[model samples]
Target chain A: MKYNAAFNPSGGAAIVGLGMTEMTREYSYSATGLAGIAVKRALDDAGLKKEDIDGLFINAGVTNAISTPLQTSLGFRDLKLLNHMNAAGSTAGQMVQFASLAIQAGMASHVVCVFADDPLKPGTSAGAAYGGTSNRSTGMASLPASYGFFSGANTSYALAARRHMGLYGTTQDQLGAIAVSTRAWATMNPAAMQQKPMTLDDYHGSRWIVEPFHLLDCTLVSNGAVAVIVTASDRARDLKQPPVYIAGMGQGHPGNPRQAGYENEVNTGARIARDTAYSMAGVGPDDIDIRELYDCYTYTTLVTLEDYGFCEKGEGGAFVEDGKLGPGGSHPTNTGGGQLSGYYMWGMTPVSEAVIQTRGQGGERQVQTRDHVLVSTQGGILDWHSTLILSPNADAGTRN
Target chain B: MTNQDQAVRPAPIVDESSKPFFDAAADAVLLLQRCNICHAYLWPFREICTECLSTDLSWAPSTGKGSVHSFVIMHRLFHPAFQEDVPYNLTVVQLDEGPRVTSIIRGTANEDIHVGMSVSANWHDVNGTPLLHFEAF
Candidate 1:
């Protein structure tokens, strides 16, 4: 659903708590088990009890029927709101928007948004497990599979990276800048998976998963989960942790699958979503203090930088050069190492990182100004996208 | 060999909407659906026009010539049948008629393939199933 702040123009709802389980290469637990751990951690961090949670929003695609099992485990007898979303990786931000709507409408007082998955676990179907699976029996999969295009994201995104290079002279080195910078942040973050500092030489020498993409350019398939708590901005002030206001948010999808599925390397739904989010937040790109972009691939961040108006179209390559996104750089992006170096909780990785930054919990990698944080999440080869602007102040409106 | 035993690669599962496209591909012709009313080309198989939302559509033969819009050399195998073709290049061909189609770029090394390179349609037979592919023009 489209997010209209006019219903509660003063930013009524805010995220008061953020938590996560250990982000490791492999976690030995059921998907539900991990989700429960994350939910409890978020509640504990918020200093709230299980009974205080009246609503639950979860990443439905991770585990089937997660709400009932989680609610039962947490000892909540009744829930005023429940949602299970399957928008690939974009569900994290979408769930937050849904939870905020519930609180504003009085359907629930406290809502928990959670994402837990074990894509790297044993005995899992390789392609169908992640965002790149095709039906093989219908739609876009039939034609592509005939040509041996059966793998997930690595191929689809590599094609996009190559298209960008061909059209705008984006070089492989420019893409390496993103990987190198994210790894620099990961060195400071204790929870990151790929902890060893990655240099430009290491990025170039990494295994070539696809022509334009190196192994390091891709996100680590670590098994982990992250969760956050959402409640009214007024109620949040009385809670334990400081409130991170949901200043503005928006979700966008190409009107038709044909547009999203065909010739999609050049454009995506993020272009439309970013415009709405910035307009609603009353802030321009210059006003954003930091960015927590969904980094499924190095090129995804590059294209998002252009689509979100951080820089002009076809200039993201040049824009990211010279360690611009590093710790001491002007634009501090993905403060928590992001999915590329940190654990891959799909879209939740970016959301969790942004929440931590906005809460001033990002110890070493925190941006100087944690006031206006912009987070972007995407699903289905940029087919679906959502942008969220967060702040530490309840009324963080940039209208001046 | 029986159908199941002879299948070495994933074959297109034909349904009511996509049967014609596969049928034409098997005969060494590339067919793209065009809305008879809006005159817009549609990919994969759609019953109605995406542009103007018209149901009047017809199967039209394409020249099957286009430039390489983008491509990837898939080093990882997602399916058992693709193990033999590991490190093969899959390219998206921007057809001159306006729709983009995915096909394996044959007759060239994966490292040599470049975007915007001209390619023409050809047929690749896999376990008796014929499919469309492209070769350097």
Candidate 2:
């Protein structure tokens, strides 16, 4: 991967604080309320007052809640930078990237990026909440829906996963390996939603939501918010918590033309995001000690590992079949159970865990090495991707 | 419950740009947008050709033949209109013309559908709405 310029933002910014609301299926608070609480908690965690936050970025969830008005609700005034971001599930990493660039460019001294959502209702099933029948069938959108091709992430991801399976001979058991291993790590983390022990048999026995995707393959839906504070790496050293240096950041959006020759399902945007982040961080996949990947589905984890150069592309099935992503495995992926077994807060699910592991705060599930951590966030049906390479050492990446 | 009590599936919202495609569907013909300049085929009815950005486009009849690029058996009902259609296969067919269309694949069991299976389009009407489906050829 070659670049025209030698400029790199690695080690220019750092995350000094982390805050999160309780992950729950049904909570009383609204999305804005959750964001307010998360922001307050983050400010407290960083030992800074609201006035110290010169920048604010908000990422709303599926409900379209939380926006610039959150600053008024949080009583923030005279901010140098504020915007609402939407890259779907990849917004968390994108927010951090923008905040890092802003701080490095002296646009804002301290920036807070927050994401919150309240998708779970009191009595409705998670499927109903996410797969509501409100999709408009008129116009161009109606063509697919008219054929009973309704809008839902499950169906789209299932199609993608099936294509990968057909092309690479990836088996259901390979996907089961990811679900089982992620559950193993979830059991060790008290914060994880599904802490019960899961096995390959249990995964296979789980009810099928879509063919090629069992219920266990899906992620948990929860109502929660997560926020992080970013500032210059030099100032982060004087903060209340250990600074997790933002070593490298990159985003990729592979437009899906949906043509015959386009293989967006088999090949994702993570490949480009990986190259950009790796080039900026000046490190290869072997240098990272922990992987906090966005596991919206078990298949996503497998494909992401392959795209990030952990293994050859078509060999992800065999790579994960040996249980290498579990608690005591060579690659400690989704150490906090990931979105599959852990709480789902979009990209924040992985970003928050990356911060904890980089700070050496993952109590029971923390990896032995805390030097470098790689975090990935994916949005849409393998359309958008963002990568973040975090480290405890401020001088981790090579400065250009 | 009587047939009248059954929930009617939502109709496709049609506008100026998509009216021609739906009009062609009403005639049981699979029509696709093609650029007059670059001769590129476009799906879902677009004003300009994606290949050459040409507004000079026209609707052309297709052979209605394609292969299953990928598919999924939807076990859970996402909409009430699909209450009786649970466990149906929602398939994406790579049309022989070069574009992909997402529709249901009929005349075959859900387990029988696989990638690269040859299929041909099947048009039907439901609640006064024309829908395009595919069947194993």
Every candidate's lDDT: 0.81, 0.87
Query: Candidate 2: where are CA atoms >4 Å away?
Result: A1-11, B1-3, B9-14, B79-85
What ranges in model 1 sit over 4 Å off?
A1-11, A61-69, A123-128, A131-140, A255-264, A398-400, B1-7, B11-17, B76-86, B109-112
Q: Taking the tens digit of each residue's C-alpha lDDT, what string does model 2 give over A1-400?
A: 1111112344388898899998998777999999988888998998888878889999999888889999998898888899999999999999999998988777788899999999887777777667655556567766666656654888889899999987899999999999999999999888889999999999999999888899999999999999999988888888899999988888888777777777767788889898889888899999989999989999999999999999998999999999999988999999999999999999999999999999999998889897889999999999999999999987887642
> Per-residue alpha-carbon lDDT of model 2 for B17-126, expressed as tens digits?
78888888899988988889998888876777777888999989999999999998877665568888888888889999988888888889888898899999988788
Count of backbone clashes, every candidate in sequence: 0, 3
What are the RMSDs of all candidates, in order? 4.0, 3.9
- TM-score of every candidate's chain A: 0.91, 0.96
Write one digit per residue (lDDT tens) for candidate 1, span A1-400. Answer: 2112223434468898787989765547767878888888998999988878878887844434365566666566678787677888889999998888777776677889988877656666434566454555564456677667755577888888998998899999999999999999999999998879989999999988777899889987766678899988877888899888988888878653443245445566778888888887888899999999999899999998888888988999999988899899999998889989988888888999998899888887778787799999888787788989999976785421
| Candidate 2 chain B, poorest ten consecutive residues by summed lDDT | B1-10
Q: Which 10 consecutive positions of candidate 2 chain A have the poorest summed lDDT?
A: A1-10
Model 1 residue A175 CA deviation in Å: 1.0
